[model samples]
Target: MVVDDSAVVRGLIAKWLGDDPAVEVVATASNGEMALKNLAAADPEIVVLDIEMPVMDGLTALPKILEHSSEIQVLMSSTLTKRNAEISMRALSMGAADYVSKPESTREVTTSLSFQQELVGKVVNLAAARRLQKGGKVYKAGKSSSLNEDILPQVSSRGAIAKRKMSSTLPRIIGVGSSTGGPQALLKFLNSVKDELRLPILITQHMPPAFTNILAEHLARASGLPCKQAEDGDVIHTGHVYVAPGDYHMIVVNEGGKKIIRLNQDPPVNFCRPAVDPLFASLAGTFGSAVLGVILTGMGHDGLKGSQDIVDAGGTIIAQDEATSIVWGMPGAVSQAGLCSAVLPLDDIGAKVIDITTGEAL
Candidate 1:
């Protein structure tokens, strides 16, 4: 289903999604109220909702829609303004599956290839994940996660962690990579163990400039820690979070015996600026065995090579389990490649990270 105040926008979205043989647009509505009225009848697995509407905006309708059915995936859409970016970030925290930035002009909207691709890709990925999550069966496992052979979904519960040995020394820094359902997942992960975090944190979430800024604010609020966008030459310290600014791949360098943040606008890696590869690789080289790399829910395998770097450097990695990830592509890749020391669900990742960094995983 597609919901927006503009008929053209709704029609365009439906048309784009319709062009894909794998997708079907079940319904369309002019606003949130109308969308709610048609919700049950539409029975849509995903809803692309516009943020600003005449009666009941996206923010007002998000929780109601989730309450109607938590299984239903909601994609919040709006022009990428500062205000909309903030609301979109808020919507993610409120249970939205993901968000797409709309083009600002009518001409741009009609001609924007990126917009069409992003919207369609998200819908397709989210729908597939929803089906997998709904149908995946979790079974009991014996001891080691390495021995579990269940391939359709997650093999076992939290106890069935990857059997790889953890790093002997405590991690000096933490580098995390996430996309898609990243904002909400990041909040949940950090909120669970913020009080016990012993090292500085670096994050490379797949977001544009405006959204990344808002995400930093939300992270600070969620974890009760100082969080800011990484600036060139800035020194990362304990208990602070530095997010990669949009369109810049943030890497850490050792200067004057301190770890300093560096930003570059080189061509995007894996089609993502501030890509996870650079951050993870840099951490791997700098911290060596003391690096802790975390791969979270995302659309693609951007962090795969970098995770390998971590593994080769004797660092530890913990990937989010497929059952808990929104797309499970990135983490799934790392998990399948045997790069992670533990494969955990979203809820358990925070505590698990804390345990490893605190030497409890030994």
Candidate 2:
């Protein structure tokens, strides 16, 4: 279903999405109220919801839609603005699957082939993930860890993990990559810790400029840690969280014997700028065996090769298990490729990091 007040915008989006073979335009509505009225008939598995409308806004309609069905995935859409970006992130944290910044005008939307493809891609990927999740193992948070339910993942035949010895030197930098369910997952992971480990953490979450700024603030409040968007030439420091700004790949280089961040507008990898691959590659080069790469919930295999770099440099990789991820593509790719040393649930990752820093080996 598509929900927006503007008929032109809605029509354009519907046309763009309907052109894709994998997607079907089940319904279109002028407002959230209309969407809610016809939702059951349409039976939309995914909703492209606009943030602002006359009758009911996306934020107002979000929870109601979720209440109507737990399986429906809501993707927030809005023009590029700071306030809209903030609300988009909020919607994601509130259970929306993802968000896309809409074009400013009908003319722009007509010309933006990339935007059209991106919208189609997100919808298709989300639908495939949803299908994979049906009747699969579903592990809710706070479940009892009975022996059969929560045992340590063992060395499988793929054996990428078994090939490397644990790093002799403790990891000096923690590199994290996430998307989709990342905002809430990251908050939970950070809140699980309380200042025990003091390594400089560099994170690359798929978010835009103003949204990344808000996300950094949210991270600081959640973890009680210093968090900021990475700026070019900013010195990396212990006990601080540096997030990659949107559209820029954050890389590290040694200058004056100290590590600092460098941002670039290089072409996106895996359809994302500030991609996990570049950051992980840089972490592998700058910190070598002293790097710990973590792959969290995401839509694609953005971190697979970079995770290999982390492990090949004698560092380690940890991944969030599929049951706890919104979309397990990134983590699952590395896990299946045997690049990860430990594949644990989201709630367990923070504590695992602290343990590893305190001399525990994978």
Candidate 3:
């Protein structure tokens, strides 16, 4: 199944899916509501969804699909915009499995035989690994994530953690970079922490422009914090999470010892606008030993160099363990490079942050 407003996109994706011999393109829809209506007839094994549409958008439809067909696996697509990046992440939180960037234009759309074959292969692989639980019936298009409390790191659940406070009085900030399984994990982490967390937070979740506003709304609702896409020359503040918009690079600058946020229209870094490296690099320069870089679940190694930069600046770094990650590439790369101070699972990550940052447990 494919759900998109653009006929061109629908046709192209449907054509691409058709190329897979083992798979079938059962249905397509122009909006989320139509997609839901089609579900009874199509009974598709996998759904490729778009974020923007009339009547119902992908994020809203995501939870509905899970509620109706727990077996259905949805993969979202969006334009390469900051808003899209944020919304796509929110959809993932609501239970959509994975996502891909739509080719920004027809000219950029891959038509080469090799690229087509590779695209088909990636889709097939992802579809095969999806799984979900609905109405007590378990169905999977892919492997199910063993999200369990037992999998968390060795830490007491007594509501308080014992740790020594950092001796240095340097100002600290938290930098988070995520893609793939980010939205849900981020929401869970942020919401789990107490409101008294001290440092300002910066995030660069992989997404496009229009979706970012939607993402911010969802994150704000879930985490009880002000979340928005970063604007040029915006000042970084504590108790807020500033997400980098899609199609732009976000960097932190120091102006008389206060941190300032800057957005750049420069070419994408590591094939990603809002690439993790620039933000991390900026942190290395601005906060140095006072920065705590965290690499979460995502594909690719966008944050690797940035993590290295933070480490070189005498800052700390953390990575989500492979088991808790949907795609372990980013965190795995940072861990392999020996740049991570802690390699903890997703559930343990929030506690660790509270312990390290506030010098107290939540």
Candidate 4:
């Protein structure tokens, strides 16, 4: 289903999606109210919702759509702005599956190849996952260890785990990477570990300008930690959280026996500027075995090679398992590549991080 206040925007998106044989444009609504009224009849597996709309907004409609059908996936759409990003993150926390940042100019909807690809890709993946879930062949959140082999064979393969002696030394720094469902996941994980952690935490979440600032504020409120967007040459301090600013690649550099952040615009990796790879690889070089790397829910393999660098440096890598991930592409890639030390569910990841850092358990 496509829900938006503008008829032209709705038609454009519907037409674009209609060209793809992998998806069917089941329904289109002018507003949230209209969407809910016709939702039962359309019974769509996925909903493409616009954040700002008349009569009702995406945020208000999101939970209602999910309440109508627990299996339905809602993908919020918004222009690249701080307010929309904040709302989108809230929507994810409210049970929306994921979100897409729409082009500011409506004309770009047809002209921009990246926008079209991202929209179609997320819809297809979410729909496919919903179908598998309805068929009783998918893993639910908090059930990573119970993953069905036929659904995720790589997750069941014992050979995927690297053989390394668990480190007893506490980590000096923590590096985390996430996308898609990252905001909510980051909030939850950070809140859970805030009281126990003393190490500086660095995060690379796929976001645009202004959004990262809002995300940092949200993280600070949720985790009770001083979190802010990284600035060039900013000193890395213990117990502080730094978020990679939008459109900039954040990397850690050692200078004069101190760590500092370096932000650059040296092209994008894996189609993302604030990608996970550079941060992870840089941390591997600086902290080596004393770094704790985490790969969380995301839509691509951005963190795979960087995770390998960490593992090869004798550092430990932990991934959020498929069951709890909104899209398991990042973590799944790391897990399948035989790089992760632990593949755990979202609920257990925070505790596991604390345990690893405290040398309490693997």
The positional error of residue 78 in candidate 4, measured at the CA in angstroms, is 2.2
Q: Give the per-residue lDDT of model 1 (tens digit) for 240-326.
A: 899999999999989899999999998999879989999999998888989999999886688889989988999988999877887
Which pairs clash inside model 1? none
Which candidate, 1 or 4, would have the higher TM-score against the true structure?
A: 1
Q: Would you list the C-alpha lDDT of every candidate in the order shown?
A: 0.84, 0.81, 0.73, 0.83
Candidate 2: lDDT over CA atoms? 0.81
Task: Judge candidate 3 at residue 145 and give its lDDT.
Answer: 29
Which one wins by lDDT: 1 or 2? 1
TM-score of decoy 3: 0.69
- TM-score for candidate 2, residues paired by index: 0.84
Top-lDDT candidate index: 1
TM values, all candidates = 0.88, 0.84, 0.69, 0.86
lDDT string, candidate 2, 1-362, tens digits: 99989888889889877876557899999999999998899999899999988988999999999999988989888887878887887788787888887888878877887777767767766766655545333223233121121111221233343323556778999999998778878787777755686788899998777688888877887678888999999999988889999889998888899999999999998878879999999999998999988898877778888999989898988999877887777887788887877888998999888878777664
Alpha-carbon error at 267 in model 3, in Å? Answer: 2.1
Please estimate how well model 1 matches the true structure, expressed as its whole-model Cα lDDT: 0.84
Per-residue CA lDDT of model 3 for 160-244, tens digit only, reads 2222223242438999998767888788778866466677889998776766667667888888888887899888888788888
How many clashing pairs per prediction, in order?
0, 0, 24, 0
Query: Which residue pairs does candidate 2 place in steric collision?
Result: none
Q: Rank the candidates by lDDT, best first.
A: 1, 4, 2, 3
- The local lDDT score (0 to 100) that residue 312 gets in candidate 4 is 81
